[model samples]
Target: MEDLWQAFVNVDSAGNITGDYSGKNIVAEDPYDFFFLVDKEVALSLHEYKVHLDGFKPSLVPKQSAE
Candidate 1:
């Protein structure tokens, strides 16, 4: 996360805002929650969830799933 934060922002010996907005929502969001989706904390695996999502390809999930 620190490496990701460094990519979005830059600071010298003293801290300061030093990045371009470029229409990204970084200005209003908390960085701590930036990488997580809201449903990630839900109490079920994808197999147990009934909703049929269009783009949730299981073939690609293993590369990123910590579990």
Candidate 2:
């Protein structure tokens, strides 16, 4: 028997996201369902690993010359 790996995204109750890699092989009874499962797992992982965006501002400002 061979082992397979799958990627997943975990979400917490606080709406936090995290990425995870599992070593479980999902046996899809239906061929069509196989792709769906894979996609769902991947999406979850991505959501978990989402990045945070902080406030940003432009630093380019015109300087006034003192008479």
Candidate 3:
């Protein structure tokens, strides 16, 4: 056993764990073996996603008839 590191794991495709894996402090040859790193800023908010708005209105309003 050595200094433990924390990371996120992709359960759908996980590798062999050091122990029974009680849901905490899992050991493995490499973090990439099971756990994966996720960029919160990128995944939560994509940088490539951008749109410019120019006050465009496409709604039609019915005009009231003068009495």
Candidate 4:
């Protein structure tokens, strides 16, 4: 038998972690990967995750305009 571990991450602007994953020193450059890690670590059901995610909204990067 194997024991599975999970971790929830919350990052803010400037690539700084600011939530459950804070102080872990894990830096991420891609928002998709970052959120994916968070979602995976949560280990929650789809409905539960949707409710949780909706309640805890994270900051998103602003889109850059083409010159």
Q: Could you tell me every candidate's TM-score relative to the true structure?
A: 0.18, 0.22, 0.16, 0.24
> Who wins the lDDT comparison?
4
| Reference-based TM-score, model 3 | 0.16
For model 4, name the residue pairs that clash: none
Model 4 residue 1 lDDT score? 36
| Model 4 TM-score on a 0 to 1 scale | 0.24
Candidate 1 residue 34 C-alpha distance from true site, Å: 13
What is the per-residue lDDT of model 2 for residues 1-66, given as tens digits with 9 covering 90 to 100?
333344433434332343333335654332220121234444344433332223432111112211
Q: Relative to the unseen true structure, what is the Cα RMSD of model 4?
A: 11.9
Q: List model 1 lDDT by residue over 1-67, tens digit each.
A: 2212211222222222233121213343434211212232221232322222236431212213423
Can you list the residue pairs that collide in candidate 1?
Answer: none
The digit string of per-residue lDDT tens for model 4 on 1-67 reads 3333333445434333344321223544433323433333333321222212225554333223111
Name the regions of candidate 2 deviating beyond 4 angstroms. 1-5, 22-36, 40-45, 48-67
lDDT of 4: 0.33
**Deviation (Å) of 33 in candidate 4:** 9.4
| Candidate rank order under TM-score | 4, 2, 1, 3
Per-residue error (Å), model 1, residue 33: 18
Return the candidate ranking by lDDT, descending: 4, 2, 3, 1
